[model samples]
Target: MFNLFGRSRKSNLRPPRAPGDTVRAKDLAYLQKWSASRAGVEGFVEPETIVNEMSVVFVDGTGEWTRRRIGGPKGIDAVFQGTGVPLYFAEETGYPQRMRDRIEKDRIVRERLKQRERRARLEQERER
Candidate 1:
């Protein structure tokens, strides 16, 4: 028997949490830190996908963002209600452009730093 692309036909299964299951304490702590940051934040409930768990993302007005897996949508709403900020379904609002821009800026900065480090190392080798 041959399988195309060497992929299994079995469904990838994840155990669902019970309805009464509580959200993780660490997730709550992260949410708290983001809420208390310099700028106000908005919450987005991200749905479960094949490669990722159900999670929440908080994007501050200044474009700072954090994301973590949470128990479920209800648990996310319950946890963030105390923040007094608007919460939206990821499907409804999608991700904010500011968050995307912030991530891109960080990536560029990191790449530039790496190039500088590599250049310094090459210079040191040449001087040896």
Candidate 2:
């Protein structure tokens, strides 16, 4: 039973990877440096989707985080093999509350900075 496109349904089960989706040396280096420099870092593996490759996010104690594409699950194991960094499946265990809190805090700080800039602009207009 051929579909309208005359292709097997199984063929569409998995989408092809986008160009440059595979892991690179730079991505590995960045992940290594960031994880090594931070304290109490935890690795969270995010599954690959149509728009993105499988990636890992490392969050430090302070909630500072960085994400980089990890070729696949095996790559993740290889990267953290001797690093001693704990790894979690992001899908199984959602992101930590601290990460969320940190994001909100940063957002608030940015808003305040924008408000200050606007106020300064208004003052300058009044002076003119």
Highest TM-score: give the candidate number.
2
Candidate 1 runs further than 4 Å off: 1-12, 15-22
Give per-residue CA lDDT, model 2, range 49-74, as digits (tens): 76566888899999999887776666
After the best TM-score superposition of candidate 1, give how far the Cα of residue 127 lies from its true spot, in angstroms.
0.4
Model 2, CA-based lDDT: 0.80
Clashing pairs in 1: none
Over 4 Å off, model 2 = 1-22
Q: Highest lDDT: which candidate? A: 2
Q: Could you tell me which 10 consecutive residues in candidate 1 have the lowest summed lDDT?
A: 9-18
TM-score of each: 0.79, 0.80
Q: Give the TM-score of candidate 2.
A: 0.80
